[model samples]
Target chain A: MAIIKRYRALIILSIILLGLSLISPERGTQALSLTSASLIDMFSLLPPILVLVGLIDQWVDKQVLIKFMGDDSKFLGVIIALLLGGLAAGPLYIAFPIAITLLKKGANIRYVVFFLGVWTTAKLPIVLFEVAAFGWKYTLIHVSVGLIFFYLVGVFFEKRFDPNTLLKEDITSNE
Target chain B: MSQSIFLYGLIAILTGLSWFKDRQKTKKALMKAKNILVKLAPELLAILLFVGLSLSILTPETISSLIGERSGVIGVFIASFIGTFAMLPSFVVFPLADTLVSNGAGLVQVSAFIATLVSVGFASLPMERRIFGKEFTYMRNLSAMLMAFIFSFIIWVVLPWL
Candidate 1:
């Protein structure tokens, strides 16, 4: 029963895929292959990283998190957010779980939002690749404009969102 | 992949160190990890399935053709729509954008594509809403799409000048 509840969406999508296959075998086959590949990618990519977050959760003091990335961390918070986003490697979806981890650990909502923003553009290795592939001028504009723009958006998000409302969903689900 | 290996090695070392410090605490963390994975798996699986379905139809070639340089503002708009809906890794994103541009896709169009590709998540909305609530998810995505348009214009004017 629990399994059915948990996999409801997956089951629905699978049915849709099956229906599509009846209409077009080629597309169905392609979607299935692509999904399996993504499955492998997600498994390989997420476990170690999520485990790392769990360890950080167990080890890092809430107070420590607050001091560094919390509400009043201000300039320091912004820098930390950028570094976290810039240094990471993974799909943008990966950032969500990690951001939740930090937010729950008491990091400021501003930095959490900013961190997710940064991950989209300024991932360091990708940035280096961008410079080589697209040249310095294009790369510089993308990163600088991306970073500055996202930071302002982050500020807007901070004002607009209530962190508790976001995180409250967790508490209800846990029950 | 090297990235996966590096992460595994890092996790192993950290786990060992954590175990050394306090065995009980380390056990708790491991259990926590298990719980977190379980809680997340369902939503993640659903997302992967949807992405697969969408990408099957919206192949990169389809995107590249639509966003050609001559397509102009219309191309930019189309690229934004596609980018917002599609999700790709950063590594794949640049190379794909590079290919599109090489194939005579305009800088501004590709820029919109790349920008919206990273910042927006239309397909991922279901999962995001599950975590962040409905309003924040929609607002964030809308904001990202707007930002992508604004930034694309910035690149259109600025990169040429630079």
Candidate 2:
């Protein structure tokens, strides 16, 4: 009951969206339907992946990851963070719980920043797709530029926002 | 065979290192993942049904009308921005993009749209907030959108020359 109350808004919104999809889908709006379906598909992947990530998070000790992603140094930590993020498989949704867990484990904000950036920006599988579709040269150009830009953007945001002040959820939740 | 062995050895070393740090944590995380999978399996099936039905219903012509155009940079810009709203997996988008490219859409525009589709879309907005918090979410998205446009332009200008 309490859980239901906690996520009432989400539950309501999801229900509304599902209902809308079921009935009276807009006409000539193939874009709308396709997007809606894609959203549902994406959401479908989220729960299981997130649950797995959440469980891993709950059990994993933070000290080791903390050392890896600590505030003590920026360069090595950000590099490792970006590599881990880029190498990671699964949807961006799957990555979030792991990132949040790392945050709880004491990873620095900048590390998280880089991970999020690369996780979204430089997916290895997607890169391979680009390579196959476009040429290796084109793919390389896009990914190399993208990685540099992702890293720079991540650092910029991390410095701009003192995550401690901006992210309030960190205050309440340990998960 | 030799290269494969080296790769395996590297992976073994990495796994060993992770195990040394926290075997229990990884084990527990995997267990939690199992539970989550069980819970979400039904939803996943439903979502797949939705995707298949929606895609099946819509024709390529419909998709083309919206984003496909010969107007060099402008069409690319529209497609990339619109991609921020449209959510589809890379696999699905690829075939569609190939079709678009074959039809009339430019390479750079498709590339830009693909980049935006993955990086800065509305699809993951809820999860982004849940995990990274809202500030990170907003900033990352805004940056991705800007970069998508810039990269699209780069691809357009450069592809012609190359």
Candidate 3:
């Protein structure tokens, strides 16, 4: 019963997919295949990424996280956040878990938000592809503008919300 | 695929080294990984299903028509809306955007699409909220959508010169 409750959303979605398949077989099959492909892509990336998160969680010292990305780190914190975010691959959802770990380990909210912003805008591989597809000037403008905007947004939220409260919510929900 | 291989190799090396340093700690890390994976499985499945369903409904041709040259402001709105809901791979997005541009979609609209595509994730919101709670999830996504619109406007203003 507990498992069913936990998976209620997924169960409903599967049922809807099944019903749609009955009405429109071709489109439904296409959707199924695409879903499977995405699942494969996700599985390929998630294990190692999650394992890395786990290792970081267990092995890395909280003091080190605070030293690098805490409120007092200032400009150095921003730089580290950008590097971590920019080097990362995979979708933004993947970043959420990692971000949670960072927050749990004493990283400041501002830098955590900055890290997410960079992940959204300036990942290295995606930047290369964007430049190729949209010209260097366009890519540069988009990335620079995006980075500045989101950094400001991050700072804005950092001022408005208490990071400890957010972290507390994360803990209670997980338990 | 290559990315996966690289990640696997890196994780293998790191895990081995971790085990060498402390077996118990290494086991704890793997156990943590297992817990997260199990917790996230249902949410992941739901996200994948939604992505697949959305993609099926919004075929490339359909998207091209919706954001064509004359689409203007409406096109930007549509593009941003679709982008928020859809989660295409980056490789697919760049090429698709290029195709749309060559086929007469406005640069502003495509820019909006790309911006929101990378930033916002309506489909992944459940997972995000699960991890970060409701307020953070909503704020992050709303800010991203604002950024997407701002980007679209900038591109519109700057594109004629470029």
lDDT of 2 by residue, B15-134 (tens): 456567778765555565555445333334333333434354445665566566565677777777657756556555666777777776677777777778767756456546654667
RMSD of 1: 2.3
> How does candidate 2 score on lDDT?
0.62
lDDT tens per residue, model 3, A1-175: 9888768778877897898899999989999999999989888888898899889988999999999998799998999989999988888888888998998888888899989999988999988888889899999889999899988998998897787777764421234
Residue B121 displacement (Å), model 3: 0.8
In TM-score terms, candidate 2 sits at 0.70
Q: Where is model 3 more than 4 Å wrong at Cα?
A: A1-5, A169-175
Candidate 2, A46-72: lDDT as tens digits: 544454454446545667666688777
Question: Which segments of candidate 2 are over 4 A away from where they belong?
Answer: A1-52, A55-61, A165-167, A170-175, B1-59
Q: Write the per-residue lDDT of candidate 1 for residues A52-92, one digit (tens) a residue.
A: 87788789999999999998999999999989999898887
Q: Order the candidates by TM-score, highest first — what do you get? A: 3, 1, 2
Residue A107 of model 2, lDDT score: 77
Q: Residue by residue across B92-129, what tens digits does model 1's lDDT show?
A: 78887888788778889999998888878875775677
Give every collision pair in model 2. A52-B33, A56-B29
Model 2 DockQ vs. reference: 0.25
The CAPRI-style docking tier of model 2 reads acceptable
CAPRI rating of model 3: medium
